[model samples]
Target: MNINKLIRIFFLLIISSIEIGQSLVPVERHGHSAVLVDKKLYFFGGESVFGKLKNSIHLDQILYIDLSKPFNTANPPFEEVINAPMPFGSSYATAFLSPQKKNIIYLFGGIMWDVNANVDKFKSILYSYNVETNEWIPPATTGIAPEKRREINGVINNETGKFYAFSGLDTNAQNVVTTFNDMNILDINSLTWSKGSITNAPLPRVDYTATLLSNGIIVFIGGRETNNLVSVDINQLPLYDTKVDRWSTMTARGVTLENRNSHSAILTSDEKIIVFGGNKDDIATPVLNPLAVLNTKVVPYEWSVPTPAPPLPLTTNLHSATLVENYMFINFGQVHPKNDSLLQKPFFYILDVRNFTWVEKFEPEQLSQSPNGTTTVNTSSTNSPGLGVTTPDNGKQIGIIIGAVGISVGVIAVAGLLGYKYYKKQKYTRAIPTAGSPTI
Candidate 1:
């Protein structure tokens, strides 16, 4: 080979290495998890098809957005936090900030692909990520972890320092194994896992919202059961008393909502549980009532639609919603499009829960100096006298669960085979159709 040709080849290799090292922005996806800490949003595993790619793959990078900075929706400022010991790629996982440790976030079960086995499996292990240290911590626990599952919901009791994980679906090799209606408790202080014996638990379900109230009661909202049935009646809300280790139900006295699953719910300072977008049926149709509220402050509880609904950009489901003071930041998910040309993209929107309206940008409340000369967040304007779930005394919001639900065994087997075929070919001409859940 000529000397000039060899030099050109060396330069090309260097360019390829540089491109490989560059971090790319996260793509639009569903069935992921997110948690907020110190005004920053950290995102984890979800499935998305890469640019011009035929099939979807589990995202492996950890992406986050700094809320303090200004950026456009078309191009948000998302930075990737790369770690060598990071967890494997998975979907339908749930995550929450530690109640005992403000800087740490905990991730629970989800569906992970087993490369060696060439099949999908549940992630049974628990993992923690430290935001301050920018590293993933090896989970050390004394007791047996919860059974392998996905689409499970959990909430942390700020007073007890215990995380209560609820119902989820378990599958193996595209076959439905079990749909659990059990509870597993993890003591955040000791990191010990134990079974929760609660009376009158509801049926096996997935993709629900578990909101921990200030009074130690966890409210379970809409989700889909094993038989593809959804809890649509706003009149009935499942209530679990973490203090008593018992379960009960409450009936609200106002407007009812449509059947929905994979929705996001946030508790306002006024004791209102605001529910956002979700799928309405087994076919994965977007719910008609995109936003509604359940006022826990009122006796018997009451449901009502906001007098004037906010103009939403799209109908979304399987998205992550993180509450920061009075603003609810809605993250990426599948959008049920009326126009077929509308493509899914990595984007977010802010809903001002104070008045139930959408805002173009988020302006965090300013910090003020106290009489002792210590800086404090000025939340007086956003604060109201009511009993509901908010950032606990430890400064960590209760875990918000958002994910997809598998419909049945036949559907799962078909979807799994289709997915495997796509994986082998590495390309496809059209998007895979999903029924209430992503293709396995």
Candidate 2:
């Protein structure tokens, strides 16, 4: 082919090779905590890339996005709230919105760097932020706080104004000290910390999700022990009764899920626990089936895989999943922990749990309303729901395609001009005769 044609083809190929990365551009973070308050979504500390450093560093600032506003997925409008009274950078922390005080959010334990000692330490302190004022309240405590730990799991009993913390990984300067199966209860009303019963508690585990059901029972699923080994069976899950301060186990029936850690789980208004994305054998190997549903309304809790599951090869771990109405928002995590190229891609996904479909954008107003005033959803096909992949706004894609074509045209024009000049020079050289030959 001609040089100009080859140039156009080469540029087009280059454009085609570029992967369409995530439309959302929140800072790449995992092991962070996210909570939905009113129409606002706020996220706290997590492990993130810092400058030229190859290793991930903990973040201290809090960032948020308003769900009421329309935003382009390619460039989400996220506002960062820095300069707050953040004591330290942290990761694998737990955060929940206070039920009594709707405007206040409580942040719990996580791993933070001890700047003075130049070592990693588990945070046992509690920090509260007032959303209305955008200020942190000074932590005042009357009771003993829990031991410093990270990768802990906790959930709030909204009715009682209590935060129940489960077992967590305890670490010191060098390595993991131990994983505790004990429980800690924090009273939001009194700002006090007290211990819970350890009798019949599940094995010392870390990186699990504790989801509180409507009946006031906390369900613990999929976590690993201190040696990074997962022994919890899906058939028999652990349970904690906050009402009685007791622990027990429940045998589930239905599809089984392999043991996993560092996953995210959220309870729906209808009493369904949606568990998604976790690490399997190791951080490098992610769980094959990233999504599962547990129906708590049934006598024996039933477990089932979502119909038309999320797009295949959806590897995620150490991610944060927050539920807002009928939609679940999964934030950044290690998509492919070892693969740098895949890890660089932004990890943000929205799932319409109403129909178990993946959606590209978030539109809260699109919820259908029934005649009486309740929100209506599609529930006809429970087992065979088709994948509803919401097509993102094509404005950005169209612009990129047009820009690519324009660049290709410019390349072709330059290549054609250069080729023409070279051809003319070659013709002139060929037309010249040798010293011993007749001129052409």
Candidate 3:
């Protein structure tokens, strides 16, 4: 190959590799957690089922992907941390990094299938994993820990190393599933649990995601009440003021988000809550990518439909997403197609929050012909604190970067090749004693 061709081929290979690497992940399942540390993503226990009547399968292996590495699906930079297996296989538990210690991930409360009893068992044990050592530490605690539960959500106060465990579902003796409205804080330093005073808390709920704001506010949205698995109204958003140890509701301004459960909601570094991928009253709503952004900085918080949405290759519920810099990594959700088959894959997707654009890992052959991209929703008031205004029009910046890089590489390659050829030609002419040239 010519020098220019070789250079062009190198850039293409890099782009191709990055595309493939983003898709390399663990087996597809819901109830799993993808915890981000530095540029690495650590994936842990989740459950899947092969047949309708078959027993639910719980995942035990620990897999992680280093985002810094080049994309290689077959030889991906995924490392399976072996040695200590979880005390039991569990799912829908709360996973977060300990604010007090470095390299420690804490997992609390999840459900496990009891094969012998043919029932689901809830776990309340607190397990900590040392990310640096790849070891599991089951920490014993004092005070009253919350009841055994699953599908619960929690957030850590990085400043105090205190983790707040929120409401979740539990099974009663009669095989009845129950939920809690209880709130408790686990102090990583003391290894103790203490109940917190929650005033005007919402009803017993599960499958909701919570985001902690810099101002010590915890916003909980889109979960099912124990009585009904149906969607909840968006008007009443629950905001917990950690400073006062109380919970209150806020009337959402502007557009209301679609009522959803089993969705992924994350607080971006820019202080906006980005919610994506969930079931709207049991129907998959994948078309809602960029799903919604709530500007929490403003009082009487308002919700806006995101611009430059992603392509919905499939409808998903029960997925998890975490934010890292300008990129949000989402993975492992239940896909419900029109054929009525429930599917889960280990693939994932990425959203560039800076521009509200999407990065897809997998594109099925039978994608819906839905219109792509989001229309401009009502804009937040300029008075809203720290609102970084961006538009769908600016989304082209990402595409431009990729195109520019590829073009730049080609131009440099061509220029270098031409320079090399010209030098060679001049040297050759000189060596041939052209005109008054002297022979050595």
Tens-place lDDT per residue, model 1, 1-440, is 75445545545544443422232466677788887765567788776654322223676567887765445565667877765324466678888777667788888888765423435543456878888786765588988677778886677765678888888887776585777778889998999998876578888788888887778788888888865666544457888888888898898788877868888887776678888888876635787878888888877888888854546657688888877667777888777743333434765877888887887766555444457654444111111112122222222121211111222343455545655665555545345565675775
Q: Candidate 2 — what's its lDDT?
A: 0.71
- Ranked by TM-score, the better of candidates 2 and 3 is 2
lDDT of 3: 0.67
Error of 1 at 203 (Å): 0.6
Please identify which of the two predictions, 1 or 3, would achieve the higher lDDT against the true structure.
Answer: 1
Per-residue error for 382 in candidate 3, Å, reads: 26
TM-score of each: 0.75, 0.74, 0.71
The weakest ten consecutive residues by lDDT in model 3 span 378-387
Instruction: TM-score for candidate 3, please give it.
Output: 0.71
Error of 3 at 428 (Å): 41
The digit string of per-residue lDDT tens for model 2 on 201-315 reads: 8888788888887677888888777665664565678888888888888889988777777888877767788889887756567777788999999968999987655464366
Candidate 2 lowest-lDDT run of ten: 380-389
> What's model 3's lDDT at 78?
62
In the range 273-322, model 3's lDDT, one tens digit per residue, is 88886776765554354378888778888888866654643546677776
Question: Which prediction has the highest TM-score against the true structure?
Answer: 1
